[model samples]
Each structure stands twice: as C-alpha cells, then as structure tokens.
Target: MNDQNPPAERRLPPLQLLLVSLQHVLLMYGGAVAVPLIIGQAAGLSREEIALLINADLLVAGIATLVQSLGIGPAGIRMPVMMGASFAAVSSMVVMAGMPGVGLTGIFGATIAAGLFGLLIAPFVCKIVRFFPPLVTGTVITSIGLSLFPVAVNWAGGGSGATQFGALHYLGVATAVLVTILLINQFMRGFWVNVSVLIGMALGYVLAGMLGMVDLSGLAQTPGLQVVTPNHFGAPTFSLAPILSMCLVVVIIFVESAGMFLALGKITGETVDPQRLRRGLLCDAGATFFAGFMNTFTHSSFAQNIGLVQMTGVRSRYVTALAGVILISLSLLPKAAFLVASIPAAVLGGAGIAMFGMVAATGIKILQEADIADRRNQLLVAVSIGLGMVPVIRPEFFAHLPQWMEPITHSGIAVATISAVTLNLLFNVLGGTERSLLTGASH
Candidate 1:
C-alpha cells in the first residue's frame, strides 16, 4: 500500500474562496470576452449588439463553469476547472458570419449541432487517451503558447488598428506590467504570490489609466442588472458546411481540454481516470450546447488558469465554483464585464505574456520525462513543432485551400495535433523505423 495526501479540492474559508475565485475570473476574463468581441465585429453587428454579445458570452460561460465544477449526474467533471469561449472556433465563426448564407442564425445552429456531436464522442475520445503521449500533448500546448505570441505583440503595439502601432509607450506599459508580476512573484508569499497576476494587472490598469489609455466607452453603454435572453440572434438556422466546420473545432477542443486536464491532474495530484475524463469532456460539450442557445460561442478549459493553479498551489474546485458565481454576476451586470474589458490592450498584453508563457513552459517541463534523445521522439518533436508553426507563421498559406479545410488548416494547435498523432503512430504504434529512414532520405 501507498500513502499520500488527497488533491487540493478541499474547502477554504468563504471569504478566501471568494477572493481566490475572483482571481481566476480576472485571469481568464480577457480571453472569455474576446471571442464575442471578434465575432460581433465580423458579423457587422451594431455597437449595442456587440456589447450584448459580450454580456451573453460571460453569462453563459458562468453557467457552464458551474456545470463543470459542480457536477450534475453524468454531466460536469466536478473538477477545479473554469470554462471559457474557445479561440479555436474564432476563424470559422468569423468566416461564417461574413458569408452570405451563414450569419448569426447559422452560427448558432452549427454550434448546437457541434455540441451534440462532441457529447456523443466524448466517451470514445476518453477511451483513446493512449494516442496522446506526453510528446503529442506537449507539442500541442507549446503551439498554443507560441500562437498567442502574435496576439500579445499586437496588443503591445496598441492593437493592429492603432494609428501609432508599435508606439514606444505601449511597449513600456507592457514591460512594466510584466516586471510587476515578476517582482510580486519573487517577493510575495502564500496567497499574495498566487495572485501576483491579478496584482500586476491592477498595477498596469492604474498605470494605463494615469496615461489616459483606458477606454470607458464600452462601460458607458453597458447596462447593470440586465437579463440575457435565449436565441437573442433569432432562431438558429442549421447548415451542413458551417456545422461541419464547428465539428472540427469541437474535436480540437476535446484534444486541448484533455491535455489541460491531464496537466492539471499532474499538478494537483489527481488521477484522471477514463471515467472522470469522460465526465469532464461531457461538461465541455454541455457548455457548448448552452453557449449556442445563450448567444455565445463554444466553451473549453483554460490552460492559463491551470498555470495559476500550479503557481499558487491551490487546487480547490470550490474556488472555481465560486468563480462561476462571479462570472454569472459579470454576465448579469454588463457594467461589471465592461469594467474588466476596459483594461487597456497593453496592460493585458503584459499579463498575458506571463500567463501564456507559463503554459508553454509547462509543456517543456512535461517533456523532461520523455526520452527526446531517441531518434523517433526527436523527429516527432521536430516535425510536430514545425507543422504547428505553419499556421502561425503564415495564416494565409492555406487560404488557397478549399473553404471546408479552413478550420483545420488555420489553427496552429490543430496542425500540430494532427502532425504529432500521425507521426507518433508511425514511429511507435506501427514500428516504422525503416520507413522513417526512407522518408528522411527522401527529404
């Protein structure tokens, strides 16, 4: 027999729980609202409609968070997890929203159908966990971090559309924010260290505010204590192409969520057996279902929060459950969500670099156990990383490809995942040493 303590999902004091949960919400808030903002623009929505989309997105995200953290029957995973709108689905949604036959209604229908598809496949995905060895998962995660760098750079440059793109002060603000987080983490202790990101963001917000950068326009329009109604975009109209596109994104979500879940288990000392894994995935699917009706995009687990979990050494699911409550409030009180969004892009960039960089570093740490020196593994890592960069390096490289393949080709994570899985199968599962050599020779 072995002796060890249970995972960190234990209860904390009510006030402490509330504060910690708020930290988690604050960390992911930028990412959670981003999808709706992007899609709203691509959909050519009015300013007011875009604001409503953000509100609905946060509201539904909160409900989904509760379902995942505080399980119900065969649904939630009951883990210390927070769910948010998926970035993976953004390109497809943008394309569909801009297309003539596929507007808001079509997007919803596809999202709903994709959710159902994900729900049915979650069990099968859980059973196939062997395919994702550390190498594959690490590559995908590293790609996630790498792909986000462009976003950070854009933010630091005062966003791509800024008249003064790459302005010196923008970089200065981002650097200052980054420094603040680093200093807090180094000197702070216990809970303070855990909330260094939040503290850094707060400092950055104040700094930017003094520089007259924070925009209150969104907040001025956002109403307080508003109710989000279902099908706010009208009845969802289903179409085959968009539904298929969304299904691709759902598959990507399954893979990324599994990687995140596995990594969190390692961090929190939780053994994510197949049963628990399936339940977690079901929550993802259910959240997607809820997102569709609630005028939002699909939801998935966030890796940055996982990094925060590791950094803070807090594993309590209850913390995240309370976070769900906070998100619900943000949803109901549009002003609250607007307040978070009003944070300057440069400020968010500084914190985002640290959060997303930690995610990539986590992947590197996991790779420490893998025998990467082996030729097969080396090649796997090499080619997988290369494939991942294709989309990030040249997003338009696949533009000439058929529209049907855009969802897969445009996503750096998806490209990496496919490359890793296929390479792993050939090198390990099929015992293709000779084949690898021949392929290497041809190259």
Candidate 2:
C-alpha cells in the first residue's frame, strides 16, 4: 500500500469531529463571558448595562472566532482557535472609564483606533514569532494561567466589591462545584471525561440554585429580545490620551497572541508559519475594531481554550465557528443571554479553577519538551516564571511605579515574555564562545 493510503484507521467520522468541536465550546464558554462581566462592573454600569455589554461582547466574540478559525481573503489563521475579549486591555479600559467626559464613547473610539494600529502592525509583529522558542512560550502561557487565578479566586469569594463577599453560602457553592468537577473527571470516560468541566458547572448551577445561592432577579427584569444597534453610546470621540493607551494595549495583545499561537501550534502539531500568524493577528485586531463599533471591547484568542483543545484532542476550527454562532444567537436574545448571566459567580469560579489549571499544565507539558538539561535553559525558565508571578502574588507591588509603566508591570504575561526573551537572547544568542559552543552541542 502507498504510505498515505494505509492510514484508514486514523481517520475520524464527521459526527465524531462535531462532538469534539462541541467539547471545545463547552470548555471555553465560561471564560469568554467573564471579561465583559468584569469590565461592565468596573465601568460602574447598572445590571442592565452589564447585560448589554455581555451580550454585545458575546456577539462580537463569536464573529471574531469565526473569522479567525475560518480563513478569509488574507485575514484569518484558519485554525481551530476561539477568540474572545483580551484581558490585557482590562487595565486600559479601567483607566479609560475614569477619564472625565470621555465616558463609554471614548473607550469605544480608543479601542477601534488601537485595533486599527494592531492590524497595521500585524505583518511586522508576525515576524517576531521566531523569537518565541518553546521555553519562552511555555513561560508566557504559564504566566497567563497564573495571572487569571486571582480573578477566579475573587469570583469564588462572590466577586470583587460584593457586599456578600466570602459569605458561607458562596464558599459552600464553590466547594460543591470543585468537588463535582473532581468526581466527573475521576469517573467519566472518552468525550464525557473531556467535558467534565461543563458537566461540573451544570451540576454546580443546579445545586447552587437548589441551595438558594443562585440569583435570577435580573433575568426576570431583562427584555425578551434586544437588537444590538451600533453606536448606541453616541458616535465615538477619539482622543490622543485614550488612543495612546489603547495602542499600548494592542501591542501587549500582539505579544500575548504570539505566545498563545505558539502554544496552540505545539499542542496541535501544526506549523504556525509567519503568514498564518499575520492573518491571525489581523483577525484579532479586526474583531476588536468590530467590537468597538458594536459597543464592546478588544478581542483575541482565548488562551484557556487552547488547553481545552489539547485536552480533548479536538482540532476542528468549525466547532469554534459553531460556538460563535451560538454566542451570536445569545446576543440577539436578551432573555436567553440574561439567563446565562444569572449563573452564580461561585459556579463560574469553580469551572475556571479547573480550566485555568489545565492551561498551566499545558505550559508544563511544553517545558518538558525543552532542552532543560543545560543549566542556562533551566535558569531562563526559573527567572522568567518567578518574575511573572510577582504581579500575581503582590498586586500592589508595582503601585509606586510611574502611571505610564503600570500597564507593562501589571501584566504577568508581558513581564514573563520580556524576561524570557531577554534572558534567552542574553544567554543563548549573545553568549561567549564557550557558552555558545555548549548550547549548540546540547541542542
């Protein structure tokens, strides 16, 4: 038999592929929704305002995910990747929210301008992929996980600024959700095992509702349907200060996307060439632009979903495209969207702990493939990861730093990426003859 012809046993049925794709959606749903909720609260929006923000975000995220997963002209990655709001822009949005007279319109304008900047620079940034070897990618991805953990912790404690934060019922629900996930993972098999997070979350939702820990007052108040009319916050008013801040956000997003693309490539055994990376970046930036126009935030690849893809071995981009469709449908149906919004924070926190932990695990798997026998490589990973953890462990450690420097110092992923790239260049790229010879020989 010809070498290719004998691979019949390796092919998957269309139905199996569909199921695998659905698994990916379940894994990423909670994470994709969290960003809008967090930002809406920070912006001091009402419950209705928060719901609108979330619905709009989901709609844009779905559209962006589709664009990224399914290639279009010269602007898509054509990978099994899901796109959502980039947390890197969270800090910038917070600052924008406080700008006098800027309001929501200013934020939207800045996001659109920043996205345009990202699109313009995408081709150039894609070329920097070569700088992210496995070691660097691993460190950055790990930092992404570490950075998000605190958000989960805050949610588990009933969300930040909550009057009932750390309430006994909230902790009880969180514990129940965690226990449910562990049980499902322990006993489930095949597809079910891969979707334990979803099952656990569903179970937690039901249990929390039964225990009176879940609230649905807002759901009842929400309208049955709502159309997302663009420019709802009045036409955007672009200003230099917010624009510059958002541009910085776009740069940070590009850096984070590079690391995420590397991680996805390694997990799927796919070659992320410069052209594909460029298209992916373009899609990300384009999505953010679209989001701004639709009254939302910056959009990019969901890093947590990368682990979901690896965990379930579901490499179908179509699945995420389908998820995008589901999200769009939710956005158009206010009642349905409100129902999802009604899921208790503790339930989301429980699911996040599992999913985020998986992200960190993926980074460890990548690190295992690196040539760590050399002490320098080990040191590179060590210093990078340690530096990344600084922000997570002590959120206020960099408070005294200059206001402009806050974005860079506050981001754990950014810090890790800088540390890893700088160290790798210093130790491996520009070392002395003896050090270089040793590195070469080890490789």
Candidate 3:
C-alpha cells in the first residue's frame, strides 16, 4: 500500500476535498454571517437590504478565507484557516452603524482604518509570542474551550430564546447526533472516523427535516439571483472617534488572534515564531481592509472552526481554500445560502460538545509538558485560569471600568495571558532565590 499520510499542506482528492470543505463551511456558517445580521437590523434597514448585507458578508468572508489559506507575499498563514467577521468588533460596528452621522459608510471607514492599524501593530503583537510558553498558551486555550461551552449549551437549548428553549425534543435530537458521532468515531476506521462530524450533522439535518424543525420560509423570499458588488453602501467616510474605537477593537482582535495562531501551531505540529505570527496577522488585516471596500465588517480567524479541524483530523489547507470557493458561490445564490443557513444551531451544538471539549483536552496535553510539578507553576496555572473564568461567569464584572477599557477587561483570554505571563516572569524569568517564596516553595 502507498503511504498516503502526507503532510498537512498536501491537497486531498477532489471528492474528498468537497466533502471536507463542506464540513468546515457548515461548522463556521453561523459565526461568519452573524455580524451583518446584527448591524443590518440595528441600522433599521429593510429586509431586502439586510439580506444583501448578509450576501455581501459571505462574499468578503470567502475571499478573506482564501487569502489566509493561500499565501500572498507577506500575508496569509498558509494553513487550514477559515476567515469570518470578528465578533470582537461587532459591538463597536453596531454602534457605528446606528450613530446619527456615522452610518454604514462610517463603519466601513473605521473598519478600514482598523485594518491599517492592525497591520502596523502586527509585528509588535507577534513579538509577544515568546512570552506564551506552554503554561500561558495552555491556560488561554483551556479558557477558550471552557468559554465556548456556554454557546453549545445555549444552542442545545434552542438558541437564545426560541420559545421552545429547553424543549426535550431539542435535547433529544442533539443527543442523538452527538451519540452518532461518538459511535462512528469508535467503530469506524481511517477516513470514516475522520469525517464523523460531517456524517453526524447529515443525520441531524435529515432528522430535523423529518420532524419539520427545519424552516424553509426564508428561502421563499430569497431572490433567484443575488450578486455582491463593491461599495454597495457607498464609499467609506473616515472620522477620528469611530476610527479610534475600531483601532481599539482591532488591538483586542490581535491579542485574541495570537492565542489562536499559537494553538494552531500546536495543532499542526508547526512552530509559531514571531515572523509566522506576523504573516497570519497581516492576512487578517488585509481581509479587513478589503471588507471595507466590499461593504462588510472586520475579519479574523473563525476560531470555532479550529475545533472542527481538530475534531475531524483533516488538516489540508486546500480543503479550506475550497470551502472559500463554496462560500463565494453561496453568496451569489441566495436560495442556496438560505438552505445552508437553515441547518439548526442545535445540530451544531451537538457536535460542538465533542469538538470544543477536545480543545481543552489539547491544552491539558500541552500543560503536561510544562513544569506542572513546580509549586509556583501550579499556583500560576490555578490563579490564571480562575481569572480567565471571571468574564465567562459574570460578564458584567468589568462594567464599572471606562468604556475604552471594555476590550481588555471583557476578554477572558487577555486576562489569562496577562496573569500567566506576569507570574511566569516573576516565578521563573526573574528568578531570584526569593522568587520561590513569592510563590510557594516546591519539592
């Protein structure tokens, strides 16, 4: 038999490529389309306009994704990365969208400015990579998984006030899908095991259709043909306030993205040095810049989709590049876009439990290689993860802080990164003899 186990950069066969790409697109669809939905509704746009915004978002997201997976000089991570609008920038963009003078064009201007700001700081942000020893990285990665668990729970309960939230039927279906995935994983071999998430989702989609839980009403209104055009909302108009606000949001994105890049490095068995991190950040920045021209919001790695890559064990960058192609086609076909969008959140939630839990498990594995035996390191991990959970448990915990400070205080990953790096330096990097006592003395 041939040794088909090539490196992650190698392309898969065409049929397998589509199968795997579909999995990634489905996993990331909700997150990718959400920003335009929020901003469109908040701007008091008509239903048709909102729909256009969504399609335009998909178009830009597809292009951004391609840029990430395929290298462009200094841009792109050249990995299995999916691109989407940054949720971190959502609040700021929404406010900008609704502001009296700063309408959609203003939002675009700020987004473009933020993209430029991101490029300028990419080098500085990537330099922080050295500070993230496995201890810090592990803490942040574990927090990411733990924080995402609530999203799965909310989805399983029918997604943020479904009127049928917490219905037994919803839980039952999600459980069935999850159980199917587990069974396939356990009993199936090789490729079958690898595509278990896709197979499980297919079963869930069919089951939802049989039970009439899948709504197709949205498709009825969708036009047969839709197109994404540049400057659909008019040329961007830049201003200091909105631009600065977005610049701050972009900084937060950088901090969050650093964790993701490091995690991917660990996932793909690639070393994530500063230069590589710089390229990845630049790809995100370039995507955001183009999003402004294309009338969309900021772009970043679709973090949840990283879990899909981890779960499916499919690491081909070409797979994600094809996922981009599928997204572009969907953006041009509103009916098909509606069909893909109809896949219920509950179905995704079921698969998410396994995928996200694996991310936390991976962090634990990384921590195993760290100096867990040292008493100081133990306290560092404990306190850092505890701090990381504060925002997750009580999102309002930082409400008293100034508005500009919202980005830093509200981020659990940022909190963990700060705490871990601080303690590590004190306990290890700045090691004086008394450093042992600053923490606890170890065996």
Candidate 4:
C-alpha cells in the first residue's frame, strides 16, 4: 500500500498560512506588475491608465493563482503554484502595439485568441513529457535558475534604469540582506527558518529606507479602492497577424511553464504525470483567456515562486491559495498595493539570490541521480547549458533571425528547453540508449 500524503492535507495553521502567503505575494508582486507597466508605457498610456493596468494584472493574476493552486475540475494542477503575467508575450505585444491600428485593443484581442489556441494545444503539449527525463529536466531547471540570476544582479545594482544603478550603497544593501537571510537560516529553527527570506526582505527594506532609497510618494497618489473593469483600454479588435504572433508567444510560455511545473514537482515530491501536466497547462490557457477580458496580459506559472517553494520548504498548495486571496485584496486596495510596491529593488535582490539559487541547486541534485557519466549524456548536458546561456548573455544574439523564429530563440529558458529536449532525443532516444539510462536512473 502507498503511504504518501496528498498535497491538500499538508496544510499549515491559520497564522502561518497568512505569513507564508504574504511572503509569496512579496516575492512575486514585482514581476506580476512588471508586464503591465511595460506594455502600458509601450502603448503610450497615461499615468492613471498605467496604474489601472497594474491593478488589472494583479486581479487576474490572483484569480489565475487560485485556479492553479486549488483544483477546479480538470483545470488546475492542485499544487502550490502561483500564476502571473508572462514576460514571454512582451516583445510580441510591443510589436503589435507599434503596428498602426493595433495598439492595446489589438494586444488584448490577440491575447484572447492565443489563449484559446493554448487551450486547444495543451493536451498535445503534455505529450512532450516523455522527452523530459531527469537529464533534460535537470538541464532546463538549472538553466531557469541561471537565467534569473542576471535579473537579481540587476536588482542588486539598484534596478535596471536607476540613475545610481550599481552604486556601492546598493550593492552593500543587497549584500547585507543576503547575509541576513543566511544568518537567519543558520541560527533559526521551525517557523523562523521557513520565513528567513521574508525577514531578510523586511530588514533590507528598512535598511534601504534608512538610506533614503525607498520611495513612498506613489502610495499617496494611489487611490484607496479601485475596481478592475473588463476591456478598460477599449474594445478588443483582433487581427490575424497579431493573433498568430501571440500564439507563438503562448507556445513559448507552455515550454517554460512545463519546466517550472516539473521543477516544482521535483521540489514537492509530487509525481507530475501527463494528466497533471495537462491540467496545469489548461489553467494557464484559461487564465490568459480571462486576462484579455480583464485588461491584463498572458498568464503563466511564476518561476521565482517555484524557487521560493524550494527555499522555504512549505509545500502546501493552500498557502498559495491564501496568497491568491491576498493578491485579490491588493488589487482592490491600490494604496496597500503601492505600499508593498514601495519595497526597494535592492531588498528584493538580496532575498532573490537565495530563492533563485535553490532552484539551480535542486536541478544539480536531480542531475546527480542521472546517468551523466556516459560520454553522450555528458555532452548533452554540456551543450544544452552552453546554448541556453546564449540568450541570457546576449539577448540580441538572435535579433537578426526571422520574426517567426523569435519566439523560439528570444528566451534563455526556451533556448535551453529546446536544446535539452532536442539533444536528449538525438543522443539518447535516437541513439537507442535512453531507455536503459532512464531505467537505471529510476532505481
């Protein structure tokens, strides 16, 4: 008889649940709002419109998270998953905006169509699970972590566009936050240890505030209560070209989301079979479709939160469900949203290092169980990791590529996933060695 416990039963107490959920909210809030901020600016929106975009993104993201973490029929993965705006769609949406007569309405129209495309393709996408044994999954997961480190470094340097970016004070603050998290992890126990990242971020925020680095001016301007209305940017007008572009973006999101789901499955000790994988992808598609009506961008699993799950050792899906509630509340209460948004980038950077690093570490741990000593397997790992770094180190490396191919080569995670899956097929499956290796690894 099986003795393992299901994910739903690993619930935390009420207070612990709230705190842990808040930590997740803090970790993901920056990324959740980033898409709308970028797209809003690209579309030449006013300050008020941008704020509306942010609120709408958060509201849809919260709903998506609930669908992802708490199962609704066959739609959700029923695991500790957090859904948010996908960065993969940004480039395409921006391009659509620049096209005459497209703009924000076209973006939303394409988003809706692409989401429906994703929903139709999700079952087929799940079939790719067979290609992702420990070998490919490890490489992809490791690539995800490596790809995110640059973002953390940029944050540690006082964010990308800061006037004083990379200043000594910013680095110092980030280092202090990193050290605080490390110290807490070492000396603390039980709940304290679990909340180390939260405490670290809180301290870093305070330190940055003391240094006059934190900005609170926006909070005063933000309204106390805001409603997220559908089609706030005007009625969506679909075009074939934009819809096709967004469909490509959805394909990339599916690949990245697959890697994240598998990584989370490894972290929580859950078996992500084809059925579970299908449900997760379906939720992503459903939320993205909903996002179009809600004045938001495409939705997918947030990779950083997956790292948080590994770091905190809190595997309860209910925790993430509570986080969904918190996100909904924040979306409705703009003042509180702005308050959390006021946390300095340097503070997030410190906590991010630990959270993102754990994802890479988990991949390494998984790799250790694979049959990597074989020369073919070794080459697969080496080549996959190397090619994956191309987009990360030089994002414009594929700028000259055909527009249709941009979706495949633009993202580090997408590149890594392609490399890993293709190489595994060439060196293992086609070479007739994958079965033995997988069988051995299973032992």
**What tens-digit string does per-residue lDDT give for candidate 4 at 292-401?**
98898899999989888999888889999999999999999999999898888888888888889998888888898789898988888888888888988998999999
Q: Report the lDDT tens digits of candidate 1 across residue range 111-201.
A: 9999999999999999756777777777766776777777777777777557787788788888888898888888878667767777777
lDDT of 1: 0.82
Model 1 regions more than 4 Å off:
1-5, 14-16, 432-443
Question: How do these models rank on lDDT, best leading?
Answer: 4, 3, 1, 2
How big is the RMSD of model 3?
Answer: 2.9
- Per-residue lDDT over 20-107 for candidate 3, one digit per residue giving the tens place of the 0 to 100 score: 8998898888878778888988888888888888898889889888878887899888888898888877767777777888999999
TM-score of 2: 0.88
Please give the TM-score that candidate 4 achieves against the real structure: 0.96
* lDDT pick, better of 3 and 4: 4
Question: How well does each candidate superpose onto the true structure, as a TM-score?
Answer: 0.91, 0.88, 0.94, 0.96
Q: For candidate 1, give the lDDT of residue 197.
A: 73
TM-score head-to-head 1 vs 3, winner: 3
Say which candidate scores most in TM-score.
4
Query: Candidate 3, residue 68: CA error in Å?
Result: 1.1
Candidate 3 versus the native: TM-score? Answer: 0.94
The superposed Cα distance between candidate 3 and the true structure at residue 324, in angstroms, equals: 1.4
